[model samples]
Target: MTGERSVPKPLVLQDEDARGSRLKNTDLSDSFLRNLKMRDVEIRDVDLSSSEVEGANMSDVRFHNVRMENARFDNVNLTNVSITNANLAGMTIDGVLVTDLLARIDPDDDI
Candidate 1:
């Protein structure tokens, strides 16, 4: 798909103080999110392609079936982040605390 794909509108990200917020089927494609602090946010079946997420503090976030291609995570602190069954091609992650981010998929492998 060219450009940003269609996704669910206006997902409420839980703050750092608010942990374990249940979320599902959200679309965050081609969006710009900066300086967001959240905890235990579950994002399932979301299209997060071509989005710009910089300087965000996302701890204990779970993403299932999310497409994060061409997304930017520059200077973002992502501790305890779990991403499953997601396409993370061309995504840039720079300057962050990614102690809990485990990439199950390899970007070098052909799909």
Candidate 2:
């Protein structure tokens, strides 16, 4: 007989409080988290590719060494966001290329 196992059901966590918990080396891909209060949380070494985040408040959040290739942000606030020494190649703002804008500001500087 072929060694084929049936797919397991998804784990559902409702009305659960996981505050102050540390989840290390865990795979939580394709998980649905709604109405979660995750303020003052630090996420490191996590893979969030193709994750859909809607109506979330991420004010004062810091991201370092994050891979956001082909990622799109809509209707988000960036009032006091600071990006330094970041590769903004092919990155756009309001449908305008960031590199082009930088070139206009500083023509001699290689972006």
* Candidate maximizing TM-score: 2
Model 1: residue 8 alpha-carbon error in angstroms: 13
TM-score list, all predictions: 0.33, 0.82
Q: Write the per-residue lDDT of candidate 2 for residues 9-72, one digit (tens) a residue.
A: 7877788888898989877887888899999998988888889999999888888888889999
Candidate 1 on 14-33: residue-level lDDT in tens? 44444454545544455555
User: How many clashes does each candidate structure show, in the order listed?
Assistant: 2, 0
Error of 2 at 37 (Å): 0.4
Q: What is candidate 2's local distance difference test score? A: 0.88
Model 2 bad stretches (over 4 Å): 1-9, 106-111
Candidate 2's error at 16, in angstroms? 1.9
